[model samples]
Target: MVLADLGRKLTTALRSLGNSPVINEDVLKKCLMDVQRALLEADVNIKLVKQLTDGVKKQIDLDNIGTGLNKRRVIQTAVYKELCRICDPGVKPWKPTKGRSSVIMFVGLQGSGKTTSCIKLAYHYQKKGWKTAVVCADTFRAGAYDQVKQNCTKARIPFYGSLTEPDPAAIAYDGVEIFKKEKFDIIIVDTSGRHKQEDSLFEEMLQVNNAVEPDNIIFVMDASIGQACESQAKAFKDQVDVGSVIITKLDSHAKGGGALSAIAATQSPIVFIGTGEHIDELEPFETTKFIRKLLNMGDIEGLIDKVNQLKLEDNEDLKKNLQKGRFTLRDMYEQFQNILKMGPFNQIMGMIPGFNDFMNKGHEQESTKRLRKLMCIMDSMSEEELDSPEGHKLFKNNDDGSRRLRRVARGSGSSPKEVFELIDQYQKFAQMVKKMGGMGLFKNGDLSKNMNMQQMNQINGHMAKMMDPRVLQQMGGMDGLKKMMQQFNQSDGSGRPGRGGMGGLGALGGLNFK
Candidate 1:
């Protein structure tokens, strides 16, 4: 089962407790049973699953229950805590020092995505202003050097690898030396993973480890290889001092549970997780956020981080226009561009609370295509039409807006109705922004920090009118929007990650919702 499915099952189990008015032993017992069943189906190691359930039960002391204690809340928290313990090794991950060269070596069995992860890490660091380089020392596997070289080249990361190098350790040593001379802050070495855990492979890995003396040794495991991950992780940890773990192909992998099992076996923290083949798909493993997203609670923190990384200058321009209450079709189009940069829509929706279950297969792709079509429609407009709040004005002032709409539709290879729809969408967004601008939300630069509940409710009421009737209803209407805002406020007020002064998003700085 996927982690999202496991989360849903566990959440259903927990909700059963809430449904029970009497917090009796039977309810708790059934809940634990459901949790155990879900974990087992996920391919979690049975022993670890038992240990987690046992821990949760031990945390609950019904006989010693105190006043004002909510038994349901206690049990839920205990279950969440136990699941985290199962995945967490409780060891500190190695941190690269600023201004000092740090070498990270990747090791794993063949086909474990070791080389791809090396490039991902290098690219990740490079984006953060670190001078990063990659070294390919996988002499055992033919084309290993070629793969690493090509991936690094695509990312523009400096790389060093010798095709004629017979000894991978020698190549690793030389690569490190070259990068250090170049003052690269982060150097990643990708070693051979072609052989099984035999004497020669282990010997070579050990030799390379000794040669580079890397700051961290990351053990990459294919998450689809269930149960075997534990032994593989143990074998690597026993020989080469594996410091951290990175599980790849977690999505669509029934063995994600087994990947968790490896963490306990190696006692190494998972520093990152590879979700997809894209270089940007490597996600930093945060325990709370992982558990939260697993349970479909949404990773608002991650969503905010993604937006912050965009640094969208066009978004900043939209923000300025919004503050002046001069939002236009041009500004709406910029917002669409920013959304595209944030990655797939459902991926974004998955990070929002209460939206996971609503997303359907092909829905994101369809939405993306529609967005492109809208952009194409905008491209066909004149500069005055593009900047005007009412794009229909261009046609309405002369003939029917239909004439201009038809011309745009033909140019953009769409129907007049579709062109009109884009204009309608722009109008709704502009109206909402104008309303927000009048509320003085951005005047103090706090973005409605001073607004009371009544004001928020009034604003949402109007915005809700501009939304699709079905979507507005699916979001629990105005009350649901208010509850969502309350969740944000509570989390931010408590200084949660990506919360506090950041507000709804600096990226959403002058957006109507902000």
Candidate 2:
């Protein structure tokens, strides 16, 4: 079973239990059986599956349960924890320290996304203010150097590779020395991806590992390989000190169960998982959060981290406008830019509870394209038009409303109708902000602080009316909607208070850009 399918099966089983009028031992047994089947089908090692199920069963002693307790919730929590246990090897992966050079060597079978993972990790640290660099020591493969060079150049990260060098160990040695001399914080050495039959290549991997003397050895596993991931991870672990794992192609893999097996095989925790082919698609792995997302429970902390990464405090001008309940065209455009920065729309939505189903319905691409078009329309606007507090009304004051709309359409390379639609969306957004201001939600810098439960409920209800019917339905109606908003208000990006700003609202609420 694919991860999505597994989640659905488990969720269905649990939901059925929730719907049952009388909770009995049979219901719990049936739920566990379904979970066990799902995990086994997902390619999780049978032993681990049994252990996880057994753990859940032991935790839920129906006879000892209090009448006040929700039996269904208790069982669900046990299953969640047990699932997390199977994924977590209980070993911490090596982490690079800032202001210090930490060499990380990559090793894996061919086509495991080793090369891409290296660039992604380097870029990940680079975004966090680390001076990162990549060293391509995969001389065994043709075009490996070219691939690294091209990707590194595009990412603007310094890289070292030699097409002429036949010795990968020498290349690794030189690259590490150069980066160390440059005082780079994170030095990643990408080695040749070797197969079990390729003994020479495995020897070369060891040589490069010795040459770089890496602080961490990352074993890249292909999630699509099913049980093969365990053998491959064990092979690499035998050859080198595999300190961490990076599972690639997780976004599309039907057999990501192999990923769980690989963890148990190597006894090393996964550091990240490659969700997509894009360079920025690698996500840091946390067992609990990963299991939560797998079960469609959402990853709220991950969502907050992404929002915090935007550093919205720098946008004082936009903050002031939002607080005053005034949203200009430029504000909307800037929010779009932030959305793009926050990574893929699907990835962001996956962090929200109940969005998995919406994403599965395949609206990610449609929403993304719509957002870009809205940005382009705004991009065509003049400074006066974008900054005007009159928003959509600013166009009406023109000598001819159609003339200004036509000009914007021509500039944006879109139809006048599309431009008009953009303005209409902008009006809806401005109205929401104005309504929020009227309710005193935006009176304080932190919107989370001012709103009581009643006010929050009112705002959620209002936002629900503006939301697409399909999305609202997937969110489990108003309660799901309120939970999503409370998630945003409970913490800013850092899990601290004062998230009542435009960052939280625009990220989820204002995104109702039809």
Candidate 3:
């Protein structure tokens, strides 16, 4: 079973507790059994699964009969914590400070995505203002140098590899030394991928390790290997000092239960997980957020961090316009751009509460298509029309302005009606933004502060009206909508790691109008 399916099964089992006439021992036992079955089916090691469920059972004491406490919530929370516990090795990985030179070594079996992961890690740090470089020392594999050269060229990160260098250690030492001399913040050394039976490759890894003396050694694990990942990870750990692990091929369909189990076997923390084939698809792994996202509870912290990474140039402009109660078509266009830049459409939707289930397989593709089409329609418009505060009126469906709408549709290869749909969505966003502005929500430039509960509900009510009725229904009506917004606001101000002012735009993106 894939991780998503396992999460669903666990969620369903927990939700069953609410349906029970009484939260008694038998009911709890049934839920535990369901949880155990789900984990086992996901290919989690049998021992780990048993320990997780037993730990959850031990935490819940129905016999204590604490008055006024919701047993269902307690039991569900226990299960959630236990799930997180099994996935977390509680070991903090080494981090390189800015302006300091550091070397990282990559080791993994062939086809484990080790090469791609090295590039992804370099790109990740590069984006964060670090001078990152990659060194390819995989002389065992043909074209290894070319692969690193090609990807690094595309990512604009400096890379060192030689087609003629027969000694991997020489290449590794030279690459690290040169980057260190240039004052690079992070230098990643990509080693030859090897299997347990390949003693020669292991010896080569040890040689490179001694030459570069990497600050951290990352072992990449392919999540598609099912329960065998534990053994494979153990094999790698036994051969070298693996300080951190990165699980690759953990996309939606991957069976990642074994990858999670491998954490225990390797005794190393997972620094990141590859979610897709794209270079930007790697995400830093946080146990609580991962489990929460898996259980369909959403990850506001992750969402905020993603938005912050955008560092949108005109965020101040957007915030000022919202404060002035003026939202233009250009504002909506920029937000659409932010959403697209935030990573995959489904991944963005999954970070918002109540959107995971709504953005399932087919629906995600359709929504992405629709979003892109809307952007295309906007692309065909003039700057005057896009930046105009008149919004939908700029393309009014009347004799005088009808030509403008038709022109946009024709230019975008879309129907006039489709153009109107885009306009309508923009109008809804405008209305929500205007209402929020009127409530002084943006006056202080903080979306999470200085708003009373009444004001929050008022804005939530307005937003609820503008959202797709089906989406609102799936979100559990007005109460659920209110709760979701409150959760977002609370998370925003939790002193967590996220760039401020991004929340203003982040909240706007969450108002998916279908």
Scored against the true structure, residue 474 in model 2 reaches a CA lDDT of 85
- Expressed as tens digits, the lDDT of each residue in 235-317 for candidate 1 is 88888788999989875564478888889889999999887777877778888878877776776666766665665433566
At residue 176, give the lDDT of candidate 1: 100
- For candidate 1, list the clashing residue pairs, or say none: none
| Candidate 3 lDDT by residue in tens digits, 1-514 | 1266777887889989999989999999999999888887888899999899889878988989599999999998999999889888888888998768999999998989999999999999998789999999999988888999999999999999998879999999999999999999999999999998889888888999999998999999988888999988999899889999998877765367888899999889989988877889888888887888888888776776676667653578877887877888888877777777878766776776666667776776777787788889989999988998866887775874688889998999999888888887778778777777776777445564667888877777777766778878877898877876666666543455323353445444444756
The TM-score-based order of candidates, best leading, equals 2, 3, 1
Instruction: Write the number of the candidate with greater lDDT, choosing between 1 and 3.
Output: 3
Candidate 1 vs. true structure, TM-score: 0.91
Query: Tens digit of lDDT per residue, candidate 2, span 7-95?
Result: 77778878888788988899888888988888788898888888888899889889899989999899999999998888888887788
Clash count per candidate: 0, 3, 0
RMSD of 2: 1.9
Off by over 4 Å in 1: 194-196, 312-316, 344-347, 395-400, 444-446, 466-475, 489-514
- Sort the candidates on lDDT, descending order: 2, 3, 1
Candidate with more favorable, higher lDDT: 1 or 2: 2
Report every candidate's CA lDDT: 0.76, 0.83, 0.82
lDDT of 3: 0.82
Q: For this target, which candidate reaches the highest TM-score against the unseen true structure? A: 2
